[model samples]
Every structure is written in C-alpha cells, then in structure tokens.
Target: MDAQPSGRAMVSRGTDTFCATDGRPATHLPVFDGSLPIMTEQPMVIEDSYTGHVSPGSAPQRRTVPGATITKMSVGPMDNNVYLVVCSATGKSVLIDAANEADRVNQLIGEHAPSLDLIVTTHQHGDHWLALEDVAAATRVDTAAHPLDADALPVRPDRLLDDGDTVTVGEVTLDVIHLAGHTPGSVALALTEAGGGRTHLFTGDSLFPGGVGKTADADKFASLLTDVETKLFDRYGDDTVVYPGHGDDTTLGAERPHLGEWRERGW
Candidate 1:
C-alpha cells in the first residue's frame, strides 16, 4: 500500500486494486497477476464520477469529460466550491467563483493552468468572490459576471453576461442561464457536449441538491422557482449534472421530483 498526498491510500491485495480515503474503501477493480488469461485491453474507467466532496485544506477533485476537465476545490469558512474548467484541446481555462483563500486558488491555478483566461464570479456574494480580486490580479485574467451583480463585485466584469449569452473556453462553449432569486444576477453556466452526450450545469447558488437556493421573500422565491422550472428543469433532461456553489453535486433527475415539494414548503 502506498499513501497519496490527497490522503488516499492505494492498496493492492491479491488480484484486486482499490483506493481508500478517510478509511473508506473505494470500488475494487480486478488486476492481473502473473497468471494466464491476462487482459489485452485496458478497462474503461470514468474519472468524472466523483462524489464532489472537498475540505478546506484537502486536495481538489478533477472530472474530465469529452471537451473539458473540471477541477473542484473547497475554500473559506463557508466551504465555497471553486471550479476550474479547462478546455481539453486548447488548454484554455476559466475559474468559476474564486470564492476564498487567494493563496490556495492562485497556487492551484499556477500548478494546473498558469495561463488562466477568465475568472467568472457567479454572483456578488461576498463568500463567492472573497479571493476574486487577488486571483484575478495574480492570473491577470479577465472577469465576468451578470450586470445586475457587477456593481457589487470588487472589480468590474470585463464581460456582462445576460441570459442566453455564450462564453467560450477554447473549443468548448458555455451557455449562461440567468436564474434570479438567490440574487438578482445569479447565473448558471451550462456546457453541453457536441453529440449531446451530457450537459454539465455549474449553478452557483441558484440550484442545489435538495432544492433551489435561499431567497429573501416569497416573491423572490416564486421568481426563482418558476425560472428554475421553466429554464432548467423544462429545458434540460434528467442526466444533466448540476454543480452548485457549495457542497456535493446532483443531477436534474434527482431533484426533479421534489419541485412540487419545494414549492409547497415555500423555501
């Protein structure tokens, strides 16, 4: 057994290989010993199927898809999830929600992608952009956010994103979906594969695993829920994966059935 920097242990037992993190064993896979019937081809592995859990001082998790690779890390006292999306073909990358801990964010960017192109603030929340100024200055990357929340940011956004607007990272294109309620300018970025393989939604604070984000009043809640239903649930399919600003991830299918419950509970 060998220990990894990410607090994970790689173990090889008999003809099986697996990883254990925090004393939790991962899925086991068959390994070939010095025996006959050796597999000629490598087994298909899905690295993107992560549990989306990160601690303040822990290593980040990476998920690679067809066109892009996403790196997720948690920072600050609020446990904000900062995501870095890098285009596979061009190496162009974008950082979403610089959140907090500028040193950590800058270090990760330097290690993974030194030439970060853009830093996108999902909204004007203080927790989301705590490290925005420092990271942007360190990387010298352009910033983007919804116009409604632009004034609240530490720095003005180079590009003001509106609903249905598109932001490109190399060959990959991200569609901006304006989800009002959590904040006036709360937005989500949706990236769909070329052949419609899977649509990834990076929903800052608008959507989450159990329900939509918090709203100030009943009116705001209504607007948020309606917009989420019409724009998100109605437009996307069940397989669409949702990455929120905080905590773990979920799919549209997992939260679709609870829309009515959310509406009734008035949260």
Candidate 2:
C-alpha cells in the first residue's frame, strides 16, 4: 500500500469539502488469512430506539479500549449509528452523529452520565443531522463540524473543525481526517491513546464495513477512494478499529485488501 502515485486527489461532497474521532482500541479484530470472516458479537450493542429508553428486546453493546469506552447505537428510520466516546480518565464524553430519535439520543448518555463536551456532525446529510438541534439543545454541548458542511446543518457549529485539528475529551485527543465525498465537510476521527497505542476511528459515512459510502458518480467515487486510500488506509495500522455510521464494525486490515475491488466497481 506504499505506492504513492503523485496526483491531486478529487474529494468533495455536494458543494462542500472533506476532512475527518476518538477512543481506545477494543479486542483486536484479527485480519483473516484468506477468507474474510466478519465478527458480530464482541462489542455490545445499545438497544435504545432513540426514545430516551431501551427497546423491549435489545441489549447495550459497550467496548472499552486503551483510554476510552465506546458505545454504538442504531437510531432513526434510516438505522443510522450514533456513538458515544467516553474518556475513561475524566469521564467526559463526545457524541457523534445524533442522527435521529431525539429522546433515544438523549438517553444514551448512560447512568454514570459523564460530562458532555461536544456534539459532532460527521457531515451535513439530513439523516445525520435530523436530531442535531434537539440533541445539542438538550445536552447544551457545543457542536463541532467541518466548515464546508457547517452551513448545511440546522444548528451552526460553535467550532468549525478542519483537518489536523485535535478534539480532546478528558485525556483522549483525536486527530481529524477530512474525507470529502459522500458529503463535503465529511470527517473521521483518529484516537491514539497515550504511548502510541492502537487507534480507534469513528468514521461517519465516509468509509464503511465493506466499502466507501455511496457516491453519486464516477468522479465522486474516485475522490472518495483517493482520500480513503491515501489518508486512512495508507496512514493507519491494520489493527485500527472502525466504527461506522451504520451496519457492523470492521478493521482497516480487513477492509484494505478489498479496496481494489471497490475502485474497479466504481461505486
């Protein structure tokens, strides 16, 4: 993956631009030898229908990494995934997505109820920010997002995040990687705990379990692929755990080999 071809990468979403959170690595998701086997039951899933209460038949999924505790919940009619990244040391947490179901999104703060530091919108997609205003108002946490998508959001961000900006939650600090394609101003976060530990990445919809997020055309797909390959796959280790906006989680190692396939398909 070290063959760097020199050229300008085309990455953007709608009229916006791209840029890319945080947590510790959970149990190592091993990269398969030949056949890829997707792991489904390690991290506990939170069963709140985003109604400020748990669903009758779902369980909460929590995973702890080096310096952070992570919780993933699927919310809204679109089944978007919202994540809570809690700093283990200070108990301060950052909420990502808040895609829908305002009540359910509020209840996910958990019983311990860490101090809510920030609400982040991965991009300006309507599904991703449907509950943005509600969640921000309820929690009173300042919002942060890339400037490109900031105007598209219902609530104006307190801080406009750019690539390379560091968002700190307690002792955890994350590097922003701008990945513009599915929507401009789309970003992913990278968290490496103290002493260069394995990184935990919260990728909104830029990169997913099997492929990059949906793109409108060949050029857009190319822009997305270029950024994911150069910024994410080329930079992060195979052990990096990726919690996407929807569906199951996967590791960079598991998804790296399939990049060629996704590119060839032009999606």
User: Judged by TM-score, which candidate is best?
Assistant: 1
lDDT of each: 0.82, 0.76
Off by over 4 Å in 1: 1-49
User: Which regions of candidate 2 are displaced past 4 Å?
Assistant: 1-57, 110-112
Writing each residue's lDDT as its tens digit, candidate 1 over 1-267 gives: 011111111222234333323323334434658676844323222235566887776678888888888889988777789998898889889999988887677767766764578898998888898878777776777999999999988889999999999989898899999999999999999999756788999999999999999999999999999999999999999999999998999999999999999999996
Ten-residue region with minimum lDDT total, candidate 1: 1-10
Best by lDDT: 1
Q: Which digits, one per residue and each the tens of the lDDT, describe model 2 over residues 127-165?
A: 887877777776677999999999988899999999889
RMSD (CA, Å), each prediction: 12.3, 16.9
Give the TM-score (vs. native) of candidate 2.
0.78
List the candidates' TM-scores in order: 0.81, 0.78
On a 0 to 100 scale, what is the lDDT of residue 206 in model 2? 93
